[model samples]
Target: MAISKLRCLGLVVMVTAQMVSAETLSPAQAPVAALDAAEPTVAAIAPQVDAEQWVRQTTSNLSSVRYINQLAALYLANGYAPLWQDSLATTALEEQLQLLALSGVSADFSRRYAQLAHLKQSNDWRQYDLLATDTLLAYMSYLEGLPEYGRGWLFGAGIDPSLPLPSSQGLNHLNSAIETGQLHAFIAALKPQDRRYTQLQRAIDALAQHSQASWPGFYQPGYIRLGTRLQQPEALITRLEQLGDLTPYQAAQLRTSNVRIYNIDLANAMKRFQERHGLKVDGVIGPQTRYWLMMPVQERIRILALNAQRLRLWPADFPSMLVVNIPAYDMSLWLDNKHVLDSKVIVGRPSRPTPLMSSTVASVVFNPYWNVPNSIMRKDILPKARYDRGYLYRNGFRVIRSWDSSEQIPIHTIDWRLVNAKAFPYRLRQQPGEKNALGRFKFNIPNNNAIYLHDTPAKSLFNKTTRAFSSGCIRVEHADDLARILLTDSGVSPQRVDELKARTNTRTVGLSNQVKVHLIYQTAWVDEDGQVNFRNDVYSYDQINPMSQKEEKFTFLFSGENPY
Candidate 1:
């Protein structure tokens, strides 16, 4: 319960004079004697202001005190006592802040921590304390994306991500921990112990070893087929060898060849590279492949670091849950630490990108109806209905007055072209049949986005590596197999579930123990072999945090260039 204050944040925060006082530290608590310089301490500031009232009001209204970061408010409220007074906590805080850059926290964060070493020399313990806490809070905000499984890093949407945790009771628990003097312990436990974090950490360590290694310059070949002699085959060989696409033995043989050629083995390796990088895996070096080939090793480390920062929010206690990695286009079902199922999934296309969120599938609906959303109906369906006379009927679609009403309206009565899209009163419902959009299974996860995982009649989309076809909902490929597993988990026998499925009629079964669903958008991960797998940032989030090119960005810790 050390970090319990944030383990869960409650909506209701109870503050008393004692709690407020505890949050506010006085100058007596500062280790001024430990400081080499005669810096101004908290005792010098407390006599000037009504500490209790100021703190109470500041903590009470986060909006009005937006200018005063939580750290500053706490320091002022505490009579300017430094929170990082303990050398152990101080050292740990500073190191963590500096290391945040390597974790791909953000360029803005890098700039802040870069100054922490130099800030306290002239500043009051209060200013140093404020900057320290601000940096710490920013790093912890990565946990805000704990729900997205990858949302915590890369500068939060300019809002305090730490507030509004799971519940107020959890928040109170964290507060209690703080009141009990477990704040240092709380800061200690801030970094997560996720397995992915471990892998990415290893990856970065490996990349850091190669960070100074020279990579070949950018390549832009028109196109290269197998056996084609290339102008920069030597450079390409160096790039492939450096990228691990070609082994030493392979490169040695290729290097010995008098004529540098795009051979079969190299092309195959390029295909593997293309597949891993979310490019067209045609085994031909083209513009996209050449672009990735030219990417710097430091950039690779930066990408891995950013992903590591985000994935650090992945809980150590990963319970039985379903995870859909949106960018990777895959869904995984985990049960008791084992991967139960992994199925290809077609996610929302770019035009209607899948919303990242977390929810619970409390029940499974079989042979479900596809209630056309107004947005889809107006944007997608209306255009077709006016052009194709039998488009609606052929697709098992029927017009209905409202969502709740089962009574079907005469589809022929409504004029497709004359209807005003903004005021379209009719609802389009797809009947439960072979042609139904919701093929035969729908995992219901209620959310404001009005999206759910369901089966689709279009199976061909799953064949494509990039399966971003549906408007906004998820279309699971092996939905029937998933349904069987879920139904059995819900206490229904497999045989019984099969019997229900054979009936070919609409039905729903309650999932006795609701399963957790996390829709994540990770672009990099480590496989079982500890190989770093990278993917295209379909949504371009990976480009958000571009680490500065300065070498000092990675080297300020023990250099003592600026020590607190």
Candidate 2:
């Protein structure tokens, strides 16, 4: 039901257009001999191999019949592709079965294989087929290096390589799974204990450009170009491997492309690759482009693996959501799963990193009040306030002294700086309007840290990609647009959102429905086209030695718990 919320939002799907099901270590139970006992598969195409004998000999345990049969159905449905059917004579499917036998190397594969074996035996043939198809679809979605959401496959629709594949109307199911919420359930149903449980999804998410076996860096012409670069396929793979992003399938795909360099197929493939990776679909490979292609796959994988862990930090459920991506310096507002608005943002500088956090928009302080942070007060404002007592008033700040023991009399007011030197008690709040630090439309999310995204009087910061200028809080470029979107359901119209912009008088607007806000940081992320994008690890996380981005170990503050 929680997942159903996403489906209500529009979804995009594309089946290879769907994805590749690669086998690995097998299941715990031995291979099923009963499948061989059942009707034998028709004599094999190409090199003839006994399907029944292979099943019986390969699968020793009858309990694994379910998984073995599931594999068979997947092979049969896909026309018995050699990869899925275990065509390699020497290393048969049984290898995976044995690994599942207990300790050893291919534990992830073996477990998946065993699960397949169980499904075949336990469920009806139709049910078995459906389950296998779903699993295979998910696996293929992973293999084609599709994101858990399949953005690549969707973008590939207009791309030349994917042009060969079938196209459909409406949302590309594969690409928009996450946006639509379908992936949440599929991901949740998976056995969390499995090693590949997180890895597969991480790989898919990382399948974007940064993880792809291509050039590295942004493809800006003068700065770093990919044109005129004579890159070897293996070299690209090697580089991606170093980056922790090269998957066996991606490596293989690149190698195959290398065999016929500069050809139309390769050109189209490159174009599709470029398109899926968030590059211009120009069929040329330049230096910056090449650099992106060469980013170590492992690095991209690590980023995605880390990001998946971050997604877990989101509220288990929220009526409405406003999530900010620190790495991209971007923020998105969503009602249900539908996107309301997205904008560029400026977060904190690296030394004063914006702390990852979450809270509800308890109140919307329109026009707003600005309580100067202590550091700014001491370093910037205090000096000015000391030089000129009227400085605070000039900047729209009002100094207030509260009555404590005696209700009638006001506490004695001293020169602001001298009062501070003598440890006087007073809170200075800036009046709402143009000069207010909070600008207009401050969505107040109650938390220990007084942090919230708001508008800024200075608009130039939005143009920079690396906008880490704030002191821990976030500043949005289109604050009013975001505010209107957040309050739309409460009967606040776009007209009102626009009107409030011109009418700058200070006023607070209470929200009928409190919105949820999440401040997140992911160094590597995927775009709508499934292109994997990476930000300069502003925190220098990539440079830190001995730091592993294991999804289970990396903790983030989600709701009230640490959902690592």
Candidate 3:
């Protein structure tokens, strides 16, 4: 389903810089209840009250409350006493809240927090017991929401983005933490567990260190080829140095040398920069690389932050899945959180970009017939057939008058030139063979979109670093091996897949369970080595800056998919 989640991500940040007005009016659905009258929570109360009865009455709407059960359990297990009343605990929570003033993730939580703050300040201390109980539990939601701020998650997949809520079994564990007086430690452990997330955090730190540095202006139309000489290359050297792409020794040599020629060393430095920025790692300072180089340091920092917030929304650990990253032109198969299959992929070109979605790998097709899309029939095949009459038959294609009937239509019976995409009534089918567009395998994922992952006959394209060559489907370099691995995983013996591949006819093998796949468009990610990687926004999703207030013209485009 389409959502404005990533779009909403830009509005706030992982850590919001929005100034908190402690004077805000009480807002949001209240938490379990308030903490001590001094701390923010759902309500204000005093001592000499029925803590258990008050908690039950105030937090009766446990399902509706963010973390009502967790809060209530903490109070209930502790004989209906306040949990976060410790000075150190309160101080720690305040710092976390202040750091996360970032309402970009969940504006709902922010409003709830403000309302709790309001209740804490109010002189009406009638519900002191309720306040003491909810203050800590409700604040727990805030801590859980920090790394995932601005990520409109459902809390299950896509992070289910629906977090903070606990199941019935978790209440026992919550009570144990309270019984052991480890609630503060328990709360402290409520951050993202992914190392990639922490890497993105480090990336932000690295960029922020130079946030105040004087950034060099973009050298427009800048193409400083190798061996090109310049009198003053100080700015160029400094910019590379500031980003840690260029080593100090190399940069210093370039800065102090009389002949500041773009040499191999400088080109190597540029390549490093290009690699990190998702550009071609050629030593040449080309237009694309120059454009990224020209971007203000602050803008890059924001971009990193935006990605970090997005990463936090992903499941902390998804044991099995296929993630096809569009921008990076790559696909990775993770099994038990380890890379089982890493293959280069060709995604849809800019004009027919692949839709960002999550689906499942339902089946495998060996020697699959290519059902040329109507769009391809109109735009690609028809025009060529009009001129080269032998194009269809010579290429092992058949013309079917109807999908159900499958009666072959004589190619020479009609005036090919007279037919256009709008008027074409026949379906084009390419016979499975050595020259078939889909080579040896097709990984099908059921979606409204016709997009799927499969093998391609055009093997040369996979060698390139930037491989956005497909019309819509993803073209994998190692489809045969991928199919075999998936088949084995699905309990379909390798011998069976091999047997199907040996035949001239098409075959389909359904998996025991559909492999979950998320075709995402992320431009920034942390690698296994803790290095942050960036890629070009091929889809232009980032054209509308995350921080910008403008919301127009950011419509979801999935024309490639058919409406179900």
Candidate 4:
């Protein structure tokens, strides 16, 4: 079974590599004419070296052990010739390195290779080769490390036990591209081609250009309410202009007008600023808005770069899928790569954060029963039941002896006071009704975490900006709409969906075709409009190392066993 799975994965990697290469320009088809014109003598320049010994030593010194074999294979593929030498290839490689350094996006690379700015003047061939090798290795390592860090935050320890590491064949393809003078194209292709990645990259570049100047801080003594005149609004206006919220014309107008007054123009500009930072767009300079405004340009650049690394983990395309962004408290459904539905969602609170995992929505259950998890039952229900004997009866909860047992015990028969968390053997299930926690419908996805998407009776929670109210399950505000769409796709008529909703009894409908669902925790991303959006890290996962460093340990509310 393991061998078969390995073979399947190898096939996928090979197909993906071929597709990437097909999309990218090869040596013959590439604008090598321009490259040749730029450096006429590059083709004549070659380095003298023992390729076998060079590969051996380079692989040994590199920390990325996974790519060492591929690097050796790359050297052998070129007939034991050095890929980077005193040629146009080396010049192009150096230009890319400088570009990366200047972008201020990759702190990990820039900090370690601050000397890259001076690499052009280096006369030593050995030093140049080592630097070039390190740069290539670092680039590959960066690509491989993103998925590793992403998996740690997404699956943690309980969901998926392991994530697929970078394969040797994939690395070899990248190495081959580098050896064949397609290093520029290879690195460019490695980056996510998504518009979000491009927008963030542009944003980073813009930030880097302005990093040298100190941005003016707007420190109002008190809260700047809407339509209020400030004692000094020059600093605020200047800051807005620097952040691109105010155009040159608007800035000039503000300077000419009553500068101390917080007019409608300034308020509108503040609202735009607020929207970019993921704050409530009330046009009021609240504490949160002020806090983000005070953040330095360099810090924002780092944040954008971090998010770019996260974007690299996502696939290039999803034909049809559902994406639940936990931090944004929102869900979007896409059909044929176009967003078909956008709805507010309630995710798990910080205490019981919604686990990030990829799975398929297999079935939808209407008028669903809430089989309360052990953690909720023990911590919440038991304590309340102990204090109030009528708690279970009022809440429409029934205690079953065990999961497989048909015997339902009377609530009065159990001694709630004596029942500790570990000793509790009975299963608690809430009957479907107006008060049912799983409100009207549930979308089940097979996972050990027992997490799912469902309707909720607490509809008012969706009105709040930060809706993190559940114990790992997602509460869809537009659950009925989502269910209708799913059912329609499964050959059910709209009238039938309405009829199903009218029914009082629970009904489970298996989907003929499952839809892929990705529960990602991206705190920062670029919207379709090319506007950068930021959100507060609701689960503190943002603090985890973006590199290959091990994440900090955490305990889940529920054990590994499926509680539902």
Candidate 5:
């Protein structure tokens, strides 16, 4: 079985190599081929270095060739090779892989890898390569089908019969497909005057009038919907058939319509997209979905390539836990692979963007005191406190009258308002209760941000799609459910939470056992069926592609290491 798999992978590699060599504009084959006429030949450079000496120097500092090879193998297995094909993407992979290689995969590597390893272990490179190959193949298949969904467009020139695809006019393809007789082809299928065709014509015309309109890339305000990427009607119909649940009319609307999506409708489409991507569906397009969508196709191809390069990164045996997608701005509490609760959350704003880290929820704080951050205190609260003595009290803050670092002593009682900005010596701490900023419960995950996932008094923010409202903390909507889960896990009976909520005195609730909480950023996610879904990078991070600027520094090193 293993041999067969290896042979199949070898065949795939050979076919891929041939296709890559034949189909793509090679690194060596520039569009301006004549420009390389003066460049040095391979023979001219051959005698400049000693291979044995170079290998020895490169190997001396590294303790493990096997380790380097494993990392390289793992990256290769994950299918990062597709990234190499796109001239625009190769440098990003090279730079990131170099940084990671330099830093070494942190404890995160172990946390994520342990779970994958448990599923299976490879005893040899051949086995690793086979598994990686399978992983890559699966990812490729998923990606190839990605364009069929509205997440992206796959561009090819002309109607190439050799390839099993129709040509795309690109996502920003201008000019009308106003082939004279083609109007009937699109309109005949609609209800005699289904306004869809007329609206579609109007949209097409608008698109044409604005043909010179900027292709603000993917994240722009007036971007295309996730559906219309399909240039052919039949392909759209076929994809909808596979999607299931979608009505024929709705699918038709998607195929024929030329509508620009807003945050709300985009949020809805994003949820349906999320459901297809294996995430907890809440109708809000969060970070993970955005990461998945906006991820460079090359990056995805690399991820797939690397999966087959080594032993499994995830161990089959693992603890029951919660996986919070930092990018998706969502959380999923799981026990034995079953979901306990899921909800939407407001992560840090772009300026104070949330960090991507993982930690165990060692404790749950009930009616926890909000110790304001220095930045917030100095910038927002202190100014208000100085301007209005009642501001602190109005916002439910209690000023610690006075305290020395070594001794606690009552100082002169200066009216909070009357005191000059420099005279304030007290720290501000809010009492945890109903009126508290942190609502009732906050899941504690230790980190530098002093940030935790918690409930909020301001529930109205959840209704908005763009909730960059928080200073730098995550606020949850279904916080109560999360609290109950933590309490139950911590050995506090469900009945006890009801008991605690009624109490007027402030107190804290600690979980019985530690639950791992991951504050990760994943803009891209795959559905249960392995369909990749995307989200809007509300912060516009996608616009920073290296290719966008010529002055950017870049390098491409051909190290035989894993690239993930």
Candidate 6:
């Protein structure tokens, strides 16, 4: 029975090889010609006496042992036939591999895949086969697993770990189809169907095509103010055209003028460029705008690809929710998947980053009391109290013995300078009023981090372009509008919402319908107008090691486990 099965597998492999050869020379031959040149190595590795043993041994020798079982099952299902031996299947796989390399999720994988492409042209068939399998396993594992850095925080607390992933069954189906010569269909099926993902993919391809030449640097030592003549403005014009900020016609017109002035046309283009880079949309060529324009295309591509991976982490079907994008310093509310409200928001500073999490807003509080955190109490308030005896009264703050106690202790009763941070037993609570830190309303979300969305008395700070001034919690610019939406959704009448806000005393209103809230830190995404938006990596999280290290980690995970 074993010999007969081996013979059958051999026949299938030969026939599949012939089909791949015929398909390569057909109307779609142009793209496959590159793969056709590497066909000798694939053909040389075609013949195998013990296919299952070869698979097991090759997979066992590698660091991707975690996928050994899945790889074994895949080969077994195919009757131990080699999947990539056929030219058509190899070409299809190469195309998908190229897509992943370009997708900025991992720069290391991209570089490694480029090396493997070179190896495919060599005469070493055995090495080719082993590396091919390893590459496939790596790609499959990445698609299946959570993003390397975010898994801990994403699945840590408040987030639902049960949220469904892009289907593993879809991958299984693609594997089955690849064995049967449905290579193109299977490859196409594996591409993410998400709209934003596809848009970013197009953006990456466009940028790559335009990246053949080195982008010009803004070399002026000082700020290029509006209507000022600058040296060599053609470089700036070419860059704006390349970035899709200016049309080719506009670029040509600007170039033909033979002038180096920062004119209205250039200013308009600069404004468009500013909008895409999450800068203040002013026409002036300031240091920030010049800095973004000087960034290389490869770096931008990496940003785009990393964000595409982030989109993969999102649930296949997103529900109506409030989303806070930390790097963008923006908050958006979605109802039935349609954007309802967008507002400027204040996020945590780099030292105290607002954590990425998901939770449901269970209730809203009007005229909310600010229960100051211990860290802030010790770091901020205690020093101020020590310097000024009347500081507590000026800020509407009172000292309490414990969180449960309502009685306010007189500030003059205790000596602030004598109180050490570690030995301090008192809690500080700010009274409900305009002078209170938590201005008027607070959206209560269930999270262990003690983070909530609230109004701020320091409303002037929201007007700043860089709004990362908070301790940790989010401060909404349009807090009243957000509160109205949340309250109205919870079946509270508009009149009742008004009455609740007008109350001088603090009161909590339970929501009839809890709203989901997701705090994400994506630095790149395609906006609704099909424009690719990039933000400064506020926390300097853009740099991450390649996926190769992840594979090494995987090997360490099951170091002594049996490969069977």
List, residue by residue over 158-257, the lDDT tens digit for candidate 6.
1122222235775566576766677556655556779888888788889999788878775776778787878868888888899999999999888788
Instruction: Please give, for residues 210-283, the per-residue lDDT of candidate 3 as tens digits.
Output: 88878776473556778877444777788888888787887777767744677887788888888887777778
Candidate 4: clashing pairs of residues: none
| Candidate 5 structure quality by residue, lDDT tens digits, 47-67 | 122333422333343321223
Q: Residue 86 of model 5: what lDDT?
A: 27
Q: Write the per-residue lDDT of candidate 1 for residues 436-533, one digit (tens) a residue.
A: 88899988886766778999888888888778877778899999988988878779998888888887778988898778888877788887776668
Model 2: how far residue 77 lies from native, Å: 39
Q: Each prediction's TM-score against the native?
A: 0.73, 0.49, 0.69, 0.80, 0.48, 0.80
Q: Please give the RMSD of candidate 3 to the true structure.
A: 11.1
Model 5: what TM-score?
Answer: 0.48
Alpha carbon lDDT of residue 125, candidate 5? 27
Tens-place lDDT per residue, model 2, 1-564, is: 111211111111111212112122121121222222223222212113433343343344433233344345434433332222211311222332322222111233345456656644553232233333333343332323322212211111111111112122111443344344354333334223444324435454444544344544333243222333433445534544434444567657667666423444345555655644445567676764565665555555544544443343445356578888776788888787677788988887765567666677766657876766555555556667777877776778765543222122222255555656335355456778777777776777777656777888878878664688877778888987777776676677788767776676766676777877887666555555434555656655433232222321222222211000
- Runs with alpha carbons beyond 4 Å of true place in candidate 1: 1-95, 102-107, 116-134, 137-186, 257-259, 280-282, 545-564
lDDT digits (tens) for residues 141-214 of candidate 4: 54565554545532222112222334576567766676566765665566566787777778888877788976
Q: lDDT scores for all predictions? A: 0.66, 0.49, 0.64, 0.67, 0.43, 0.69
Which has the higher TM-score value, candidate number 3 or candidate number 5? Answer: 3
Candidate 5 ranges with C-alpha deviation above 4 Å: 1-317, 401-424, 538-564
Off by over 4 Å in 4: 1-82, 85-112, 121-126, 145-149, 153-167, 227-231, 545-564
Kindly indicate the candidate among 2 and 5 with the higher TM-score: 2
